[model samples]
Target: MNFRACFVLLAALVCLASPALAKTPVIGVNQFVEHPALDAILKGFQDDLKENGVVVEYKVYNAQGNVSTTNQIANQITDDDPVLVLAIATPSAQAQVAATRKNAHMAEVPIIFSGITDPIGAGLVTNLEQPTANVTGVSNQMPMDKHVAMIKRFMPDMKALGVLYNAGEANSVSNVRRLKAAAEAQGIELIEATVANSSEVTQAAKSLVGKVQAMYVPTDNTVVSNIETVVKVAEESKTPFFCADTDSVRRGAIAAVGLDYYEHGKQTGEMARRILAGAKPQDTPVEFQKTLQFYFNPKAAQRMGLQVPQEIVESADVIIGE
Candidate 1:
């Protein structure tokens, strides 16, 4: 073959053998801690995006239940200038919002949050219907009235209910406040034991042992990260332990009427899809989990010195530890 022919043939081979130079969008994720519910949410988020043909790269970060570390992670994510940010919990979401606001370069990067109990109360957004900013996501806010009624179902004659949570988490604080009002309306006194961090959770749970008939845990990252400790305390004390997330029921809580966090993450993922497809976060309304699921663990109930109600067993969406 002539030199010209060989050159053309080499060019063709290079074009065929070389990889495509398509740029995949990068998505930064800041998860506050590692737990069953939050892990499920991240899974659902990734699966939904994949199923919907939203090809992207992920830069995942876990704060491991540290507020300062969450802030640092958020700043690092901002510096990465990802196409978007997915904040898993209230603290992570708040940190991302703060970091983005401080860095003008990331001002346009949209943030979608999941597993947040109270977005408005967390200061993530001012209005749910009209976000009016570059932040909007899903709220896993449990129905306070329904939750109170559910708790009452297990302890009909209970005069007091104990709650353990981290007072610093805006979502937990909001949940506890609403729970208190609902409990009071039902003539049940709310006994609160606030913990500043996960290490303090066991002691906090012990404090409420005899003072209350049963113990409850909100969707607090700090409390949920160290849930087994609380479970141990409740099991030894014969105090029925309850949770606000269905995943916790499997982890040892007696029962819960809570959102399916996987579905909640998918909802947030849909919002993210829209944002990536040219929808402004300011125009997109914040979403909430549409369906709530009832879950129970018979063995957990037994360990906490309680029996699973027949009605609850029959009606539970998920019945584990049978």
Candidate 2:
């Protein structure tokens, strides 16, 4: 073959390999559902990477609030051979961890997670400093005591607080336990209701209708998605509702003081950048995000015949119309 023809062929091959040669990486993001909370997180993650000059192709996997779908999406994302992966919620993160543990293909891919309230309680890692596994990530952990405090502010004479959680979710279990402890410490009683899925939420809520003076809604995905039913039951019975997720406040809860999951996503991206830059997963510290925000819905408060205190109203980051 002539030298000129051989040189031309070599140039074409190099051009074709340019993507692999580039320092920028392809990142896979797994979102549990299309809920407003998780969608904000996806936006923050994408925005951070774009600003940092990192070439990232993100695939948002919506589990549609199904654990089975979360597992399936995790498997599909792992097959794409991304440099790293980001799981948006607790279920999605757990599903990704399960897929990576069982397989050899994604064994080396670093994982970052956001919107998870309790990474350790969920079995995602052994320690906060070092993950001791292929996965390390950020947590949108809300302060349980602070949440109860906010609840008390609205209902100064509050007692017999009802809490709804998904018994199957470790994160929910952890949060509920904290809620129980906090309620006891404040001289308030806790009424517990465990719902397996969205289908059972309304019935579970009805059980709490006349028994509890107020309801505490934690960051349970199942209950969060089915909040309208809970709201319907609670409002009709003059039972006040409180929440731990900011989105829940928008969805009709009386108030919320919790982690900003979207900011938590940007925090996740910072760790992801470090992992992609050759740091081991264990070397990076797992972060518990501290950006808690408060939202109060005066309409819901009025519906329950409750008046929020002046100081508590001033503490709100966002206030809804009454």
Candidate 3:
């Protein structure tokens, strides 16, 4: 226990304090459900972070489309004390925001939410231009007018338009309002069926059969998590089901005019990178997709005994099944 021993301890402490030797920063990613769109967003976020030179260790958790489980995951993530939290969907974001409020340590943890359609309506932010809160991220809000127009374009005789969504998702609820307005303006009746979880999606879709001419799905995580159920119902009912997410078109929806969830995730990751680089969430305005894509499934159209309009087929950005 002489000068050499004392010097060795001092050198170890210096190394521990050095930024180069510090442990990789950890980020918590809480996803509400395991759906293709949300999964793509998660992938885009991680990929973008890697591409942007941000080295982060992530603790990913899935809620499996359960609200209670979502809250539990959020609480666990809060307890882990990650540098930042990325909530994938509206419900997950709401749960994480509530959990952080309950945990004093997590209250300061910056949150970035992706795949949310209505940040302001969901109370996730005070304003889109100025968040004024510790939570800010990308919104996957598609244009409802364009969606309604696309449906009408395909089925010129469409009278009643069906909508199946989760009443619990704020984003879906907000989009439903827009859809209703659009329907009213187009002189089309809007038939609504709400589901609380993925298991109810098929029943909800079935309820729309014969009651409406076609079905339009909002960007609701619950409904999209079980999109195949809705698709099966639509196919059996011979009702063309349209979606607000492009990824859903590939999964069997007849068509969609919207942005890709992967792109939404990349935008979310870029915002997270800004947050990590000392940009406060309160100062960063919420971002939205600037471009949209048209996707259609000709197989789905034929299954429903409908013919894709020549104009729509020509204008589609991506056509499934040729």
Candidate 4:
């Protein structure tokens, strides 16, 4: 070969091997379902990375509130071999964890989860301070005591409380157990309504009417994904509707004492950043949202045949619909 041709080949090889020309890291996001709260969590995670100047490409997937679909997405994500995986809800996290464990190559990839209520109970990790496996992220566990108290404050004469959830979701089941205990301690009967999917949510909400004075919904992906149906049922029946996340208050729930899901996502993202910067998921402790926000909607309360207590109105962190 000529000298000029030899020099040109070497230069081209160097350019191809340059770090600046490397492909962006891929983050696989497996969300259990599409809901305002879960969606906010994803937005916060991406925004945090962008704000910190971390550039990467995202491969996002939604389960559409189906368990089989979540498992399918998990397998696809494992095959994709992304740098990291972010599971938005408990089911998605569980599926990803299982899929990665079965694959030798994907097991090493970090899995970060957000919008989960009970990480320990969900079997994501045995220890919070030091995870026993390659899975750690934020837990948006709502205080059941505070939630029950808030419901009581809104309805002093409440004799029975209704809960709408999906039995398939580990996080929702965990929340229901906590909520049942809390309600029982307050001398309130807890009525349970379980649904298999979003299509069943309307009937579940309808069944609660006339049986309970107030209705409460946990951060169940299936139920929360179809929150408007419950809202309509509550409004028509004048049954007070409460939720476990702040985002639901804007969707016509009377009140909620829960985490700002967007902020919860940011917290999860911060943990992911650490993991990407050489922090192992097993070494990283599970984090919780430090600050909780109380949200109330006076217009929603009126529709539900209730008057917002002045104390709650004054103490709420956010007041929806004025």
lDDT string for model 3 (1-322, tens) is 8999999998789878896875778999999889889999999999999998999999999999888999999989987779999999988999999898888887678999998889988888988988856899998887788889999999888899999998988999999999999988998999999998777888889989999999989888888878889889988889889999888899999999988878888888899999999999989999989899999899989888788768889999999877
| Prediction 3 global C-alpha lDDT | 0.89
* Residue-level lDDT tens digits of model 1 in 19-129: 464456899999999999999899999999999999999999999999999999999998777999999999999999999999998888999989999998999999999
For model 3, give the 10-residue run with minimal summed lDDT: 15-24
Checking candidate 2 for backbone clashes, the offending pairs are none
The lDDT of each candidate is 0.91, 0.84, 0.89, 0.91
**Residue pairs that clash (backbone atoms under 3 angstroms), model 4:** none
User: Which candidate number would show the highest lDDT if scored against the true structure?
Assistant: 4
Candidate 2 lDDT, 222-297, residue by residue in tens: 8887888988887899899988878888888898887776787777777777888899998888888876778899
Q: How many residue pairs clash (N, CA or C atoms closer than 3 angstroms) in each of the candidate models, in the order given?
A: 0, 0, 0, 0
Give residue 53's lDDT in candidate 3 (0 to 100).
92
What is the lDDT ranking, best to worst? 4, 1, 3, 2
**CA RMSD for every model?**
5.4, 4.1, 4.1, 4.4
How much lDDT does candidate 4 score? 0.91
